[model samples]
Target chain A: MRFSIQQPALLHMLQVVSKAVAVRTPKQVLTGILLEADDNTLTTTAYDLELGIQDTIHSDDTNQLDVSTPGSIVLPARYLSEVIRKLPSDNVSISVNNNYMTSIQCGQVEFHLHGIDAEEFPKLPEFQSDTQIQLQSELLNDFIRSTTFAASNSEVRPILTGTHIQYTDGTLNFTATDGLRLATRSTTFDDADTHNWTAIIPSKSLSELSRLLPDNDTVIDVQLTDSHSLFVIGETYFYTRLIDGTYPDTSRIIPKVQRTEIRVNVKSIASAIDRAALIARDRDNHMVRLEVQGQKMTFSSSSPEIGNVSESVEASQKEGDDFQIAFNAKYVLDALAVFDNTDVLIRFNGSNQPFTIQQVDGDVGLQLISPVLMR
Target chain B: MRFSIQQPALLHMLQVVSKAVAVRTPKQVLTGILLEADDNTLTTTAYDLELGIQDTIHSDDTNQLDVSTPGSIVLPARYLSEVIRKLPSDNVSISVNNNYMTSIQCGQVEFHLHGIDAEEFPKLPEFQSDTQIQLQSELLNDFIRSTTFAASNSEVRPILTGTHIQYTDGTLNFTATDGLRLATRSTTFDDADTHNWTAIIPSKSLSELSRLLPDNDTVIDVQLTDSHSLFVIGETYFYTRLIDGTYPDTSRIIPKVQRTEIRVNVKSIASAIDRAALIARDRDNHMVRLEVQGQKMTFSSSSPEIGNVSESVEASQKEGDDFQIAFNAKYVLDALAVFDNTDVLIRFNGSNQPFTIQQVDGDVGLQLISPVLMR
Candidate 1:
């Protein structure tokens, strides 16, 4: 089919769906983006089997697009994006000539690219279900940040590689762990209706969706079929298949009580841990010990090759008894960076047991790290 | 060795010398920076054998340096840079408490790093020369811009991997060639020294020195010895060993005669070549053809698998006769970008002969690119 569209509008849609267009796709067709124009909208879709994205744009300048006939074609993603990005951002005329030549004309510049018939493109899975939930764009992005990092990245244990989501009545919960660290975040969804639902979404897909979401305070509609889940933000729709397996009960891995807890400024603790990490990198365990005595806490790490470091910092809380514990510095630092709080309270049950880190004021976000074997 | 220096001053020097310190050096001492403090001046040096840098800084708030005995110590470059960068930009106190204990204190943050005595560090080449030449910093930096890119970067061609400079009788000439392309620029020194000198300086070292030069019109001294060349700018003395063997005769490769010449606007020609190169990338030759007839020139390139394209551009010169020539579009564009003229005259002796790209109105720079064979 033949149709014309504005150059800038087409470029916008290409950027949205081009994320899934792998440079080294096993199937050559997956490297191309399928474009279709009908009525007053042009839709582009790209998929690499594991994940897929579709984006649509509405046009007002019909001259840029004149539908001599209605059909579709798959054009190379990278070349098209480059051509349009270099074009002047004015009214650009784009049309399919001879059902094969895709031409874009702006001022003195003209670009012509070869196109593949849309019939050869793989069909995108049809996601149809009634289980749709609403989530604020910012809050959902934060939820992904808080828990996605803990997901096991290895494909050997496919179930643990995904973040488990549990929802009931008016609340949605997210949990993930990579055996060394566990993270959980839950938020209230006033409009969430259908109760008792659980699904394991791949951490990678969740991160991609979080990065692509708009910065404004808009509501994103999340829907899940029996086997796949869809996240629709603005004019783009992102879909990924659910991990088919069972997730472990991580509730028991985090400590339920604490014998001693201390409140340390988030920035100070983060900086101290960063310095300790420099020395910890030379060690196989990458462990750093935190000793709390009264209101003064000391952070230290040692390596035979890089020598040892000991830093003393003050905290707001001192209680119970003096104690020292060692934990993986990377996991704890990664968890604390996502919080925008002044202070964080780290609780310890014993030197050899799992420890919990939470915001000092309230349990707005919770993170748990399993202690490593350290001597 | 004991000294206290402002964090910013130390960080700046670290950044300058760290450029020569490679992260993966087999000699452990090469990965560390040598710090030597005596009296009121603190000197720092970092070397990777082929290139080295020594910078001295004077500070008042850093105390009297308190050198009980003058000594040298080598410390890891990356770790020191990172630690100093994150520290507050105030006076920092440094002391050696034990044989290996190195402690740095600034505000409430302190960093302790292991250090090795500086006797293990490589000896920097000394420049012993009575003859010296001076050039404007801005001009030297700009000259580097006009020639560095053409130098062959492959280590196998050691001589071609460096920019060759020759000065005699007040005129200083710079030449570089990477086999496929050559760039040459010359300027007259006001001193009118009758001494002749030649040296091959690595392209990477020249570029680094160019970027670090102060942005002013001050004259920078160029001192050359048997095996080392020094560019002492302000408080920093940059040294790089000269590559052995004679540099190729780039002067003879430039064509002195022409059969057909065409003058075109530099910006228009650059843009067309850039666009045409996009399509030419699919072929090994990456050949883009230029046909000049009357005052209009056409640039065209195509692949059998990817369609073909031709665009018409305006030109000002049409001498001798109409002709067509094919050249690697990337090389042609790169050479054109180095020209500061608005319009350039492209001269060709024949369809397959090496061509010269010169400023249409000036003679500040000249670039030559060898034509590629097209099949």
Candidate 2:
């Protein structure tokens, strides 16, 4: 392929697709990025079996890209990234010979890179699906952030490593759990069709998708298939394989009754827990205890070797009987991070039952943490 | 000990002294910082056998510090740093009980930290030294930066891990080498005594000292003894033990006669070498070659598996004969980084002999690099 493009534009496109390049696989072609130039568009593709990313840049009125010949080549992603980053000029020209030997030139610098034929690269999976949904990029990002952290990091139960996403009526719900802790978020979209569906997507895929999404109100088109899902944002396409097992029913795990409830400032409690964590983190479970009495809430943690820490924060509102609970400090911190609101409402059934936390005035997000038995 | 100090001031003092705290030493007290409260000043000290650092904060007009009782105790550096960093108030109160159980209070949060008697901590080494020299902190920082990178990281030759500093006739010279490359910097101080002395300070100590030095032209008092060197910067005292070995003489290795000399823009050659290094770093030695013909200089590097790269930069002046030399690209990059001047003059004895690089107009810094024999 023979083409000349603005260095910045090419670099941006390469960065977007390179995330899918395999790091250390037996197949050499999996480590390369496929480049194809046809007509006025240049497309870059990278696939690592589990995930595939493709982006295209077109030659328009700005003349940022100029194609002299239509062809394809696969170049090693690591070296190509380093070369592009160190190129000295604004415009770069690249050409591939019959032997797949590529020459990249910019001003006084030139590099000859050995490339594999594009045919050797794996083809991205394509599926036929009639179900398509449109959602704002910012809302999808929020859903992913609120639930993904609660997903299981271990592979003991592969299904728990994926977030359960479902659509019913005009509302979308995302839920993730690791047995000990659970997080869920829901949002309503009036424009979505009434057709309902559910999918279990790996948390890693959702995280990567969140990073690629723009922070604006641009609409993203999502196509769901039985085995694969595709997300189209502008000229980029991100695809990931769906987890193959049924997700657990977490609805019964969330406590329905509360014996105690307290509303406190998010920053005050977060800081208090953070300080307590400094002592609690030395233990295996990272346990911190929270006690609610009247209008005051106290957080305390101690390690046999590191002494103890205690801090009290005044709750803005309290109701019902007072109670105490001990749970992982990291779980509460993660749950608190997803809320932009200043105040959070926490409800407890008992010291041993799972407690739920949510925004003081909205039902958009909810998180539940199971208490750990304290000695 | 009972004291109330501004959180920022205590944090700053802890950070400065914490650099000397032992990471994984057998002596438990080495991991703790010794805190001493006198009438009006609170002192913090940390020592790890090889290095000791002490800093004092006084209760001045701003009343940043208040000492109510005079006592001393040693507290673990890691936990104390974390607690002070997370304190919620500007002013923090610390008190040590008769049993050395310390209570730290700030705002509504309180921590009870276990502390050891100050007598258990290793005492700072005492030395008799009347030879004192005063130099600007900025100049000492410059000397450290220009020479420290060339120090050997390997322990094969322990002497090479230290920088040889010599003072004679009002001039201070700093030099370091790792067998393959050598860097030297010299500066003059008019106020220094004519009495001559030399010391080999570990590169690690110089690096830490450089970080603590202020950027302004504040005078620093340096006292050199037989076995230790103490630098007093304002209220901080930094003590480091000298390396117990004889340093090799590097004067004979720098080539005196040259057959080829070239003057080139530092940025142009440095950027070319940096780009070439992208290809060269995959090899064992990180080799990059430079060929000077007339006024054009070319840099090239190749790996058997990763292809090759070539770039040309124009030299402003050339003398004697055209030549080609190969050396470690990282060595040249590190040497070039010490020079802020745009132009540098490089003198070459031959293709195989060591070449020297220096500022085009000044004699303050000089670097010598040995070329590798190519296949």
- Which candidate comes out best when scored by lDDT? 2
* Model 1 residue pairs with clashes: A4-A65, A4-A66, A5-A65
Off by over 4 Å in 2: A61-63, A192-194, B61-63, B192-194
Which model scores highest in DockQ? 2
Among these predictions, the greatest TM-score belongs to 2
Across A160-216, the per-residue lDDT of candidate 1 in tens digits comes to: 889998887777899998888889988766764665678999999898888788766
C-alpha-based local distance difference test score of model 2: 0.90
Docking quality class, candidate 2: high
Per-model TM-score on C-alpha atoms:
0.94, 0.98
State the TM-score for model 1.
0.94
Error of model 2, residue A49, in angstroms: 1.0
**Model 2 vs. true fold: TM:** 0.98
- The residue-by-residue lDDT of candidate 1 on B1-375, one tens digit each, is 677777788888888888788668678889999888777778889889878888887656543344444556888888778878877678777776677468877766677888877778888887678767887898898789888888997987889999999896777889999998889999876675547888889998999898788778888898988788999888888989888889888778888889888888898888777777777874556789887788788887876656555677888776777777789887887798887648898888777888888887766578898887655
Q: What is the C-alpha RMSD of each candidate to the true structure, in Å?
A: 2.5, 1.4
